[model samples]
Every structure is written in structure tokens, then in C-alpha cells.
Target: MTFTAMVAQPPPMPDDPGGRGEDFGKSSPVGLLVLLVFLVAVVFLARSMTKHLRRVPASFDPPAGKHEAPEKEVAPVEKPEEQKNGAS
Candidate 1:
């Protein structure tokens, strides 16, 4: 009356017409068609991406060692002189 003895017994065979279940060992035509369609779509997408990428420039940065205007130095402001008490 243990669990092992109960599961150890084999299941009764089914009286199917073909004497076997559906065989999945071989590829079907529909599966091959789906794979072919996926490959074609990927090729088209890659070609489109390449065409768009070619229009972009290699770099958008400004040229090195070039200045539009010369730089100027700023002078420090002078302070007012302190007046003595009531002095002219």
C-alpha cells in the first residue's frame, strides 16, 4: 500500500487507429515557410538601416585650432580714495 508500488504499474495502452501518436520528429512545410519569411524581413530591415546611416556625417564637431573672434583681457576696477574727517 505504499506510493512507489502504486506508480510502478504501467499505464494501459490506448487502442488508437494508427497504433501511435502524432509524430513530431519531422519538420513541417508551414514551419519552413515562417522561417523564410523572417529571414527576408531581416534582410530588408538591414538594408534600410544602412541606407539611412550613410546620410549622416562622420563627425559634427567644430574644426580644431580655429577661433571666430580674438579674446580680450578685462582690467581690474580702481577703488575710490578714502576722505579725511571734514577735509577739503
Candidate 2:
């Protein structure tokens, strides 16, 4: 006996009452211009701050009577050659 298989089909899309024309009129051009102005002001302020920081000089010495020497680090003790040869 031979059997025939049925092909599957996608469901039809729903109709939109308010289409693409209804969405186009809702955009605000003035709000977009204000956002652009604010972005430009922020970029200008950031560039000014970077220039000010670059012009400043670094202090070489600490405040008087507060100067202290940094601590010296102790290295780990290495094994002698005589001990290595004896183990082998």
C-alpha cells in the first residue's frame, strides 16, 4: 500500500486598519534639533576638559614632613648547586 503526504501552509496575515500613512505624521522635528544641540554641547565640554587636564603639571614632591621612603621587598632564597647535585 502507498500513502500520500499533505503539504503544510502558513496562516494568512491580519489586516491593519491604520497602515504606514498613519505613522508618518507623529514625528517631532524640533525635539530632534534640541537633541542634536545637546549632543554638540556635551562633545565641546569634554574636549575643553581634556585640554585643561593636559596643560596641568604633575607635582614631583609630596607635602613637607610627610615624605616617607618606600619599603624594600625581600627576594625568595634560592637552593644551592651542591644540594641539587646531592638529590640527583
Estimated TM-score for each candidate: 0.45, 0.37
Q: Write one digit per residue (lDDT tens) for candidate 1, span 9-71.
A: 657657873635556367799999999999999999999999999999999776687655568
lDDT of each: 0.77, 0.82
For candidate 1, the lDDT comes to: 0.77
- List the candidate 2 regions with Cα displacement exceeding 4 Å: 1-27, 60-88
Reference-based lDDT, residue 40, model 2? 100
Question: What is model 1's C-alpha RMSD?
Answer: 15.4
Q: Across residues 1-88, which tens digit of lDDT does each residue of candidate 2 receive?
A: 9999998986554576456444655769988999999999999999999999998878767778878877899997767986798789
- Off-target runs (Cα >4 Å) in candidate 1 are 1-22, 64-88
Deviation from native of the Cα of residue 80 in model 2, angstroms: 86
